[model samples]
Target: MKYIKGIFWLMAIACVIYAGYTLHSCRQRLANNPMGLELGFQKEINQTPVVLQSIERIGQWEFLSIDDEVMVDTTESHLLSPDDHLVRIYHGTLRLGIDFSLCDRGWATASGDTVSLRLPPIQLLDRNFIDEARTRSFYEYGTWNVQAKEDMYNRARTRMIQRAMTPQNIKQAEDNARHQVEALFRSLGYRVVRITVGRSS
Candidate 1:
């Protein structure tokens, strides 16, 4: 039992000494090399997937606005009042941008020092564009029903979207997206970046 224990301890000491020597040799060779790469080649690290996952919406534009007036006539008798109507001005702002969440497949690729990026289509970012509480009542001669006000809000929202989402605006957004993404790729050591934009983008 005593001899077995002694041999075990000697083997353990030899292993420790061999490990220290190996570590020292590795450090000395690394010190002699400028890049310290053991194989003299570094694996190309593709970060497109990671970047796409981290990104959400990009190229947000919200400058266009519309002032829509909704007029509602009263159903009451004409003898009681000469003219009864509700007039409200809906001030709505249209915001459009690219949704990166939809960029699930074939959005980006990288080969050598070149990167190819495809941006998603531009769309309305917000659902509730019109703030009814913020709507100003230009003139109100009678009480307006809830359904009429809701319909007016919907109409205003549709008109604002239609007027704002133009081909020129979509192209501008795509251009902005390309610039931003190219800069990002350049920062990541990419020499050339190619951008692909679809119809809606």
Candidate 2:
């Protein structure tokens, strides 16, 4: 009976140590990047067929951003007269998916009641998704002889990319793809669907 009690106490201590370590690691991860996944749920996907071609777009997101910039013309050797302070508004869309043109083969295969599939990683489908017509200068002041407006366009693109690449967006796209692919296989009468993605395999 004494031996049994000792064994139980040792097990309890081990469990407490493991739980404390897990909690501490999670806290440190959150402190580093609250949205980043230290371990991705799953990864892996790509390649497809005509049916995939029908999906012209997936994981579409529209975002609006405003940036304040100051361009100084150092060539003018002016303290302030040649500087332009500009506020610009950007309207953009981000799409995540596989490109049909890039898919040389189909992702789905079946043998009897079981089906298997491999998919390409979800990628940024469109980098030139900004609507220039919708973008406008919100506020502008000072000189015309300063820096060109080309940098402003680049800035807008950078901001849009940052907003679109959040962990939530990537996870949502992966979840959507999983559901869609599973449904497609099920519709074709596959009783067993086995999917291998990333390290989750």
Candidate 3:
């Protein structure tokens, strides 16, 4: 009876140790996650407009004439150095019109309208550097030892999930992209700008 009791105590102690070890391993795995993954900006410039207007008064006859607005639309390609990221800008055409109204108080109202100034789809400026960095990091630290291979794998996977799929990481990437666009627009004289990001994969 005493022997059986001792055996029972031994088994309980072993189970407790195993459980503690597993919890400690899991905690350690959670600590090795890397943070921050962001790509550069991919910008597309659409159209630039130039307007010409003329007004003249001759022999008591008032005349106002305006030429069609000119638009320079061209694709501009930019490549980021060191990262070899590619960004293409597709330019669109601009449309210009005018509205004129006559008033009873010897006054007139004239307004110019400009339309069709838009941007093309901005694709990933570059992802080669990001891919290479991830690959190298994985190869360097994702190796395994025969004795602890399984533990290492579990830890690595946990770390990858924590690093790659964390809500904070997603938010950071989106914020970075939005800031890039905001800055681009600001440079082009957009004083009040709003940025919105959709869900990413």
Q: Highest lDDT: which candidate?
A: 1
Encode model 3's per-residue lDDT on 1-201: one tens digit a residue.
Answer: 999999999999999999999989877776787643459886866688967687654221111111111111122234663321222121211111111221123222222321112222222221111221222111222223444433433344444333444555445545555566557666766665554333433
Over 75-103, each residue of candidate 2 has an lDDT whose tens digit, in order, gives 22358566546666767766765544443
lDDT over C-alpha atoms for residue 201 of model 2: 15
lDDT of 1 at 47: 64
User: What is the C-alpha local distance difference test score of candidate 1?
Assistant: 0.69
Alpha-carbon TM-score of each model against the true structure: 0.58, 0.53, 0.24
Candidate 1 clashing pairs, residues 3+ apart or interchain: none
Candidate 1 runs further than 4 Å off = 1-80
**lDDT (10s digit) by residue, model 1, range 51-161:** 445755454433223344343233433676665576667766566666667675968888999988876676767777776777787677766678877876777777767
Please report, in order, the local distance difference test score of every candidate based on alpha carbons: 0.69, 0.63, 0.38
Better-scoring candidate (lDDT), 1 or 3: 1
Q: How displaced is residue 104 in candidate 3, in Å? A: 48
Query: Lowest-scoring 10 consecutive residues by lDDT in candidate 2?
Result: 67-76
Give candidate 3 regions above 4 Å deviation: 1-162
